[model samples]
Target: MTVDNIYDVVIVGSGAAGLTAAITAKKNGLSVVVLEKAPVFGGTTAFSGGVAWIPGNPHFQDRPDAEGGTRVDRAAVHDYMRHEAGNKYDAAFVDAYLDYGPKMLRFMERETEVEFTPSLYPDYHPEAPGGAQIGRSVTAAAYDGRRLGKEFKRLRQPLKTITFMGMMFNSSNNDLKHFFNFTRSPVSAAYVAKRLAVHIAHLARYGRGVQLTSGNALAARLAKSALDLGIEIVTEAPVAELLHQDGRVGGVVASIDGQRREIRAARGVVLAAGGFARDLARIKALYPHVREGGEHFTPVPEGNTGDGIALGERAGGHLSQGLPNSAAWMPVSKVPFPGGAIAFPHLVDRYKPGFIMVNPAGRRFVNESHSYHDVGAAMIETCRGLGRTEAWLIADHRTIRKYGIGFVKPYPMPLGPHIRNGYLRRGKTIQDLARQIGVDPETLAKEVETYNDSARRGEDRQFGRGSSAFNRYLGDANHKPNPNVAPVENGPFYALHIVMGDLGTFPGLVTDTQARVLDGDGTPIPGLYAAGNDAASIMGGAYPGAGITIGPAMTFGYVAGLSLAGRIADHRAGQAAE
Candidate 1:
């Protein structure tokens, strides 16, 4: 038994969760190493919007008008959580998260290079009790990847489908609006020009854009912090098995550079490996649509294949059961490539005006402006009733040119390539588009007519499209009457094939409040912890807001690190005493 190395903590996965745990553990006077199966770090987080739904964050503490302002009411937050989690609400876990989440945010910004700015996003269901229209979600500040020096290449880049010529845009909506209106507004044009110049310069020097934004920036900042703390991030190292000895998980057996190596952990091993989104067999069993023999696509890193979950289950950790949904549902459209297609999540385009999603019958099923999860769930149920598994996002020529649909860019970007490649379907009229998309011409025409009647009046009486703050946040604020409601009476029309997908899995390894992986009987497994998508989501499989996935991930990572360092109890005692 040749032991290659030993550390106080071994974090499996290098996404936001693992890197956060590594930094926290190291800062608490423990040696930590991060093992990532992929050639690069970041996991699915690198491809995300990079926002965290962190209530009571300190960013706007002094601003009374802000959501995170002095008026932050803990009881209201608790009520919202209870409403969101419903039957799956675990009071202890939720309370721990609420107590420690803000602390973690403050610590990361103060003690490390990671920084965040308050976002203007609202709660997905602000109409719910105790929900606020703003002040909860925060986005990672854009970071210069050049600061990482030689290791910059190891940081995963944003999804190529979302980036323009390899340049990532900020997820705060400001950069996107500027680019969208560049041709019409001089101020926006100037901003776009400056941004393009910087991106071009970066490409010439770095072979990739070094001005990282969104989740890529978050990943880079965390990686830099971990590296500065002397934490070892071993990429291309896949943990094959858990090291269980004396009723405790001590370390892992990882394949590093095609060589097997045994690395031991003195305190514990934290399972922060991405999730089971790509794990075919597991997802087939857990995901409703997949189990029904429907197609599912995901844009997450392919390296996430349930490695952590399998390792934990093998070591006697319990897999949580009976969540309403198994993953953070996302509606995605396949973008045509050279040889195949890639899943592009419909994140921003759905909320824009002059567009509506329809079923095979050409009828609008769900509110297109709703959160991705709610829309996805509705999509699944709608398709199930129709005995099929697909939907179409219908848009007019004017709308498509203004907001763009799916992978197709707005005006001047040239939609010819997408149309020719069959990634986009277009027609000269409403009836022509219905035929092009395999729907009844008369039915689609009638549906469009009915929608336009209400749209012209700035109302969605059927589904209440623009009835919430969250819906309007992603919409064009300059639009008249209602930002999300506009008559689609233009000549030419287009349609995009939509399918089911996910941001990440929800139901995961069952763990206690301290992040200790629990056995089937709810007994804690010694020296074993889980965070990130590897652990069961605290939101109980519900989509609460913009950053629900990453928010709890980071908070639990902080908790797990504290537990590994034997400081969690002391901290809890201090908090209780306070």
Candidate 2:
């Protein structure tokens, strides 16, 4: 915690990646310290789904499904990565990750409070070669926040949008069915009542709900593991530069409590402090600012401004280029909420029934029911053509009452506020809605007519909306015919603007299979490594399913630990020889 303090491993960013590296390094008998730039621990991982899409996971070993099929195999994992990565696939990286990924998960389970379940979430590309129809993604078992005690206050909270009334929303089928069945079914009503009773009791005690899932639970588990191992986690400590010793990376100079502090690393420094989503200038250099004239916002913590990328650059680390996306992009909507304007990532709502996306030309472009990354990427390409800077999501009163559009809550909740805030536009006719949103009236009218006809037939001949398992998984489960297909045929329609939002920045420092940061000539920067968004992703430009980000993050963090131990030993041996 002081200048000149030295540790065997110094990890920047206290998210899943950084903490995993810290834990694994400690497991290897290395003294480790984690420095966080934000005011609290748990970077974006705390606000995430907390699912790790690691195939060959042991949790699925004896797990059986309602349909009686096991979920994973090593071969299937290989097929998925190969197919998803396409031309950008890295065989050695995939092989290395596959070797260590499950090992890391098992180690965490055996050694830490981090428990995982072979969750029923489907793959994003379920039909891909070797992809599991059910999925290999595992959700973090819910942790009671009170166990951290006062330290729980130091854990970053999940995004307000991901939670409901300050309580983390469980996304499992049974959990969701309870919420969706609020007024319709007695079973759902009872489930909600029981959940509310527990939540209320928790709120009275912990000040936050007791049930922690998603990223919050993931962060808490990792943080608790570090705490258990006597690892020091220093928040509000920003690494200013990667220090060098004899032309090799040694440690870091950071700013803590507004004072410059030098922390010497005896072995190596791992960069996992997230990516450059908040660094608008930096992001614009790689991606065109298509959101400038329209709606665009990121739900990631504002503290994420590419500190790791910047420090690595100063230390001669090479930033990667031409990723599938420079960030984990998603469509975001800005809507006025109780306290202020909240930028909400339109995840489940877009893929649900009764919604359509149109660019400035009032013509439908991408498949609305596709994965968020795909939809956002398509929006980027759509914007590039003919200077179209805006897009809109349209839905009918029925969809709004059932699923909620943008920030507007379901029916029974008054729609007046959203309409007043301009987050939603209401129109009695399709042509009127088009004019209200500045779209060509006739073109939008035609698009609507065609879409309505397709919905009636339970098919989208244009985009194949309900075709994939992943797509249907996100759609209305109880809907008839195709869950993703629904007619927007009623009057009093709603619309919200779309923009490029991302889970986090991508295309970070180029690294080898060992998770060591690379140089311009494709050499590892000695004493330097990266994981999570801090390093170029192993998944190339594709998002295969849930937890892809966190899965590789923890895997390579473990790899970084193992690699650092070897690198340090080799360096020591070389010194002894000298």
Best by lDDT: 1
Candidate 1, residues 2-96, lDDT tens digits: the string is 22489989999999889988999999999999999999988888999899988888875644534233445778888998999899988777678
lDDT of 2: 0.82
RMSD of 2: 4.1
Tell me the whole-model lDDT of each prediction, alpha carbons only: 0.88, 0.82
What's the TM for model 1?
0.97
Q: Which ranges in model 1 have alpha carbons more than 4 Å from their true place?
A: 1-4, 62-71, 385-387, 570-578
lDDT of 2 by residue, 372-431 (tens): 888888888887745445589999888888877766777567898778878789889889
Provide the TM-score for each candidate, comma-separated: 0.97, 0.92
Off by over 4 Å in 2: 1-4, 62-75, 289-295, 337-340, 386-388, 567-578
Model 1 lDDT on a 0 to 1 scale = 0.88
